[model samples]
Target: MAPVSLKKLVKRYGALEVVHGIDLEVKDREFVALVGPSGCGKSTTLRMIAGLEDVSGGTIEIGDNVVNDLPPRARNISMVFQSYALYPHMTVGENMGFSLKIAGRPPEEIKEKVADAAAILDLTHLLERRPSQLSGGQRQRVAMGRAIVRRPDVFLFDEPLSNLDAKLRTQVRTEIKKLHARMQATMIYVTHDQVEAMTLSDRIVIMRDGHIEQVGTPEEVFNRPLTKFVAGFIGSPPMNMDDVTVADGKLVFASGATLPIPPKFRQSLTSGQKLTFGLRPDDFFPTGHGLNSGDAEAVAELELPVSITEPLGNETLVFVGFNGRDWVSRMLNPRPLPSGQSIKMSFDLSQAHLFDLTTGKSLVA
Candidate 1:
């Protein structure tokens, strides 16, 4: 069945604990990505799952068997590293089949498995090439090919695409997605790039400071972040946040900009309560230029001076002065607004977020 579960997993380096008591589950054939900034213990957690590190606390189960004490090889898992870890002297075919060869598989069987994996990864034509002779993307494919030949119960990838250039990363990302669909094997991927996690994973496990911040599908995490950190970290360009106070039934920012409290939050807030207001660039757009211009009743108007504008082909990222800092907004069907120019922007408060200042948690139920 290959369902994996971590029960209160903990990792400590001597007296300094890194991974706290975190629990997670990976259903068979489901792809999950652990993502966070550096030193979040994501890689450490993955290593623990691979049996490369000792667990300081908690139990890990693959299917129904507890695998805490098993060596990596005995755990029946394969890992693809960012380094591409292929032997420089060996051909791609030989590299892909090395693990089976080490297990004393017959040459014919190794060849067949390697050939199958190569065809699946489209590395058939490059099988004879050495790692140094292949492009970065090809080497990564060969690395994936090596893991595929193992046919393990779980696949662990640690920032496998970070070594590739931007364009190649996208290309290989698509390949990995296809590979998962083709094999339907349980996979756990770790990366710092939220975009990678959002685009590639069935569900994302966002970690921070050795703790899991949130675990949900991409939409859930992006649209309904449970914590202020998750809301800030999940989106592209991030969510625009400002310190705000409840005053006279309105949200008053430090810069004197006042907005009506979102109707859903009005009953929950009281005057003088400190809060943080969050708005994604997607929901803050210029009037007459947003995705839902027809929903005009939901829009709140604001006049702000443009700080800068970044044109991103189909949509433009507009930066304007708000609450003493540049707040970014995404404008569809955009027109250029020069720096320092005052423009009327539309804010879709229906999607706005409110965080309790003291708890750093979302105000939504």
Candidate 2:
């Protein structure tokens, strides 16, 4: 079934280790993304999976077989790199079939496989065009077609869409999703973009400083982040956070603002405990502009002066001065409000998050 397993994988350059013996499992035909910021060792882990990097310790298995000693070609995995890696002089069809030709496959077999892959990737019409003649999106499709022709058990993509513009990146991302569905091949994609990871992957592995921070489905990580770093990283505008201390069953901010602790976390907290209070823009909004309809008991109302506003057609992002800082709040079906105007804001404490100041871990439990 080609389920890939990595047990205590490690990578080191001399004595300095870059991958800190992380463990992960990819189910057969599932799409998993390894994502993090730059220098997070995500690309390095993907390289090890493709047999392009040597494993310093532990075992890597594809299905039931150990492939640590196997060469790239023998691992039965296809990798599409960040660069298209196409030959300047060769046509798209030639580039797609080059691997098969080098393997001494019959001319008819190579042609058939390449033609099939080209049709699947909508590159049949551009088969004769060289890489230089195609647009960025078309060139990326050709790169994917090359990998498809191999019919490998696993597919590896290393930031394949990062080179494209925003529009082209979205277009290519959709195509890659369709490709995975059609092939039903185990895929491991690595990228630094959180949006790409959230939209493309069935599960995401977030890494930091050579260590895995968390691994879960997009919804699991976003709605219930286990750590403060994850809560800050997974959301679009990011979760708004401020340091506070527990006092008299209330969260006291540095600016002397106080908020009642939500009922769910009241019992777990104690007076004088340091915490980082978090609330998403969606949960903190202008009184009538919020998305939540349920009557939450911990809701707080305050009139805050607006600092600025960003109108995004369907919704406006309002920056209001709260606790001595400009806290962003999402306003749906927005009405134009000039800067310095005071408006009633709602803080949904039921949707709030509390993290230990020292450990950075969620205090929900």
Candidate 3:
């Protein structure tokens, strides 16, 4: 019953407003991630929920209580930051149990809580080690262990893995996922990394310029983005975008390339309307090499020139010249594609996206 409700949340720094009238509900035991580029107010929103920042307007409720005016400790939540915030001189056990110790909890109770959290995070062996002696991942786990021992109603993580190396980030991400499953606690994570938001959250809140752009499950945001900004921001290497216009019942690119109007939008789009066409890198494949080979009704073929190829072990990313831009394509079967080579590529229009140029809203529906 530890659901969190944010009602028309707003934040302002004197004369400047940052987070505007954003509302969200985080279900009990659900993991929701707040994600957006810098200055989008994701962090400010999270801080408001944690009672770390004062809400300029709106109400924040935890479970059944209005926590807007409550202090961070009174909100009954724990936060993990990018800085780990561990005491360098204190041993892991001491650091993890320090909050309880400060609250006048008995030594025996603190020990039990610390031991339990340590075991859950696989840090029992490192309890005696100081932060200075631990690896980056270990320090983060200790930081998480500190939060777990509090047994708070909600957990807030602010880009907790941004400092880790690539390999370590992947490993810790898996560990955090496991931790979430084991605890089943309601959590709200703030991060700029869409990949982290996709992998860790049950739902994602995408924000921009003090406003929320979209809120949906990772699949919904990735496969059916509501706006052009979200379609381009949520994917790795992102979705390709090109300016286009409706002419003669066809989608004509500014570079003079043309694609037949997708049947789904033919009735809604008027002639002379401008749009931003979008296609994911994975949806564009070399001929006979697409993931959906059996589905060819919406497939369009184009002989495009390659600009560069990046080999990533099991797959290669082919950068092809399209509409006078370098469009990336993910090739499943690994192969060396020479630059300046012309290759037949397939565009899966079945998965294509179109946004109104004037509004940036999806053209569909």
lDDT of 2 by residue, 1-365 (tens): 38999999999989999999999999999999998889889999999999999999888999899999998989988889898888879999999998899889999999999999998888999999999999888888999998999888899999999989999999899999999989999999999999999999999998888888889999988888888988898887888999999999999999999989877898888999999999999999999898874756878888999999999999999999989999999999999989999999999888899999999989864
Better of 1 and 2 by lDDT: 1
Q: Please give the CA lDDT of all the candidate structures.
A: 0.93, 0.91, 0.92
Clashing pairs in 3: none
Candidate 3 per-residue C-alpha lDDT over 1-365 given as tens digits, one digit per residue, 9 for 90 to 100: 29999999989999999988988999999999999999999999988998889999989999999999899988889999899999998999999999899889999999999999999889999999999999999999999999999888999998999999999999999988998998889999999999999999999999999998999999999999999999999999899999899999989998999988775677888899999999999899898766863557788899999999999989998999999899999999767888999999999888889998989999763
Per-residue lDDT value at 50 in model 3: 87
1-365 per-residue lDDT for model 1 (tens digits) = 29889999999999999999999999999999999999999999999999989999999999889999999989989999999989999999999999999999999999999999998888999989989999999999999999999899999999999999999999999999998998889999999999999999999999999999999999999999989999999999999999899999999998788999986787889999999999999888887778763556667898889999999989999998888999999999988889999999888888899999999889993
Candidate 2 — which pairs collide? none
Best by lDDT: 1
Clashes of each: 0, 0, 0
Cα RMSD, each candidate: 1.2, 1.3, 1.2
Range of the 10 consecutive residues with the lowest summed lDDT in candidate 1 = 290-299
